[model samples]
Target: MSHLHIRPKEAGADKRIINITPESANWQFVGFEVVMLEADDTLVVNTQNTELCAVIISGVADVTTQEQLFSNIGHRASAFDGIAPYAVYAPPKQELTINALTSLEVALCRAPAKGLYPVKLITPQDCVTMTRGSGTNLRHIRNIMMDNVDAERLLITEVITPSGHWSSYPPHKHDTDAIPQESALEETYYHKLNPKQGFAFQRVYTDDRSIDETISVEHNSVVTVPKGYHPVGTPHGYELYYLNVMAGPKREWIFHNDPDHAWIVNP
Candidate 1:
């Protein structure tokens, strides 16, 4: 376990209107909110009660929601939902300087409103890359929010396991519901680590009383998922990233494991 969980953009609790709905890890359910904006931040204007989707995990930011006004655009990773008296401007607070650096600290992931889902933007060449075992390497980012096509929870992926590799492999669980094949989903794992450093070993239980718990994640660590049958391990070297929040009732995220390890899913 490398261990890293950094959240210091500075906003302890001045209230100033920050409901989040009640999910935890800085509000985890109505939509999602993993906010962090430094340099000369200003997040006022609640928009009558929250409705935002800000995502720019790097530097440079200047936004003024309610309708318009955006300068410098949304830095690197961009995603902004809608309808809000939103406002975020950061600059020169002391000679803004962050050039060519890889990952030293930068994040702004929020989701409070959007028709109920369907807002995606995954870069890293769209990610499909995967290298197995303990020396794991992976990248899977998804966002299908909701389509209501039956809408139980269609898709939402963000899994990047680099350094030591291995991700929720060989251990699966869907809870129940077997019709077309298998269907059940309820998962949430939000962890981010690059230079923030180490720690990554998560394993939920269920193998006949299996109730194991080991969580030592850093860099905005977050792991909460009621059921069991979870899997995520990256030990050998390090390098791990996570942001795979899911919802279920039945849209499609089938699962069926615990059958003698299911033959390790063959290769």
Candidate 2:
């Protein structure tokens, strides 16, 4: 398997599906994990030196930070439910706990921090929903912790692409630190399909083709984009959903589209 393509291990209902750290990814920032929990089960997160953002992918969860209680924190039985989720952010060196009020699925996104921020509960009301592209390029986006939100090193979001649609389209890249033009950000795409048995396609490549892979992504799998113009497509029958975790030397998310495919955006 290519280092960028990560497959999930066989997991039971109450187990972590995927876990990636900066050391494991050979990158400077970005860490991700997915977990499933039965009702009343709990998980304690040791933030260490990294900030943590826990996004409830499904079911309800209660988050506790120090003395604060953020309760009943989620909606929708699936990401395809067309609703935004609840997210909790915990600062570095601190610990937070998640108590699953119901069967829960959550994604933990992390990055290095200086302990400058506080624990914050980002509700669906705090998120901005926008639809990008049109026709077969159409996709729905939930901007959970983008630039407008208060966070030091994370720019998180979730996207839903309808069947017969494309997403992260026009083949965009953000591997350069040229501030005005593009920002260098390492990203991960954690994908899930409506039917557990269905699959999707994602392509990661550079202008020089130094890194190129067209992956058949199964449910709960992830694709790491260290540097490339990455784009995704869904099969005609399966709706696609993905959570994106991005971070880098800076926190900006400016990207440049591939010139060869830029014309599509103009028409």
User: Best-fitting candidate, measured by TM-score?
Assistant: 2
| TM-score, cand. 1 vs. native | 0.28
**Candidate 2 Cα errors over 4 Å, as ranges:** 12-14
Please give the lDDT score at residue 244 for candidate 2: 97
Residue 116 error, candidate 1, Å:
19
lDDT of each: 0.46, 0.92
Kindly give the stretch of ten consecutive residues in candidate 1 with the minimal lDDT sum.
78-87
Model 2, 6-90: lDDT tens digits are 9987656547889899999999999999988889999888889999999999999888888589988898799889999889988
Residue 178, candidate 2: alpha-carbon lDDT: 98
Candidate 1 lDDT over residue span 89-160, tens digit each: 221111122221222123322332323422223332333333344434343333323231222232444456
Off by over 4 Å in 1: 1-30, 44-167, 175-183, 186-191, 196-236, 241-244, 250-255, 258-267
Output the number of the lDDT-best candidate: 2
